[model samples]
Target: MTYVLTFLPWIVYAVLPSAHWQWAALAGLVVAVGVIVRQRAAGYRPDALIIECGSAVFFAALAALAFADPDSSLHPYSGALSSGVLALIAGVSLAIRRPFTLGIAKQSTPPQIWDHPVFVRTNTVVTALWTLAFAVTAAVLAVLAHAGQGHSTAATLVQIAGFVAPMLFTKRYVAAVQARSVPQ
Candidate 1:
């Protein structure tokens, strides 16, 4: 669910034609608010608050741009701008020592293991990988957008790989560490 929410804005922007790109910010704002409300209603804090905040900020900026300069040329670069915002959010989370994954991991992990060195280290590494993926995705998307090919096949593949790579790595890395921790 969190993953879907995190990717909602990107999905929206990608699906819509270029002319509707500016509306992606509105779509993102709606999804972010829905996620926040649903999580709070269920008595569970959302695991991806950083993502939600980033979306909110992006939406606000877009709204301001629309209001201030209705003819601004930011619509074409919506994909790259969105990716850049996500990368910034992930990078900032790492810098603050509160890897965004830490919150998601805590939801499933036992409280006793929350402060364990292994757990902390695992999440840190996972978060680092996520940050790197976002950064690379942003760079690639930026280039594509600059070339007026943001919706090209290469851009789509890069976006898919960006999310899938870290997801697969996290699962495999966690399982391997867990297997090793179990003694004969």
Candidate 2:
């Protein structure tokens, strides 16, 4: 899925040791570009353009920073920074009245319902949940990074739970709403 692909680089960066972080960052950039190319080739707008673009920018910035000062102290906070970027993207999407999830949701949604208030409202709520998740994840990661435990198992679990919780909620919430809408 697009979401999985988008997070591939982050996962790589997280799993790799600190010494190999530069390589991990580069790998993430490569994956992001590849995902964009593949999605475009399929005549589909990539599901998470904002996230992908943000990743590319982050990677590029990190690459430059590495080149400028290989020993920069900021390197350890990469995970927190990544989560913060995600939070920004989600918040901006909501502010612009174009929830990032709307595009992904539209891929499977019928054209007739695209303009429905319920459909729009559903995506808005889903987007808000995602925004909250990213914000909380960013905050937690920041705390972990400050404590010099960003790469600890506990931090990893928190990050995974942050994403998975909203994802599971979205599925269940949507299903429940749909079921309720259908006549008995």
Best by lDDT: 2
User: Number of clashing pairs, model 2?
Assistant: 0
Candidate 1 positional error at 37, Å: 1.2
lDDT of 1 by residue, 73-162 (tens): 776566677777778888898899988888777767888998999898998999899889888888888888789877787777878888
Models 1 onward score TM values of: 0.87, 0.90
lDDT scores in order: 0.75, 0.78
Model 1, position 60: C-alpha lDDT score: 69
Tell how far residue 157 is off in model 2, in angstroms.
1.5
Q: For candidate 2, lDDT tens digit of each residue in 91-117? A: 898999988878777767777997888
Superposition error at 8 for model 1 (Å) = 2.6
Off by over 4 Å in 1: 46-48, 66-71
**CA RMSD per model (angstroms):** 2.1, 1.8
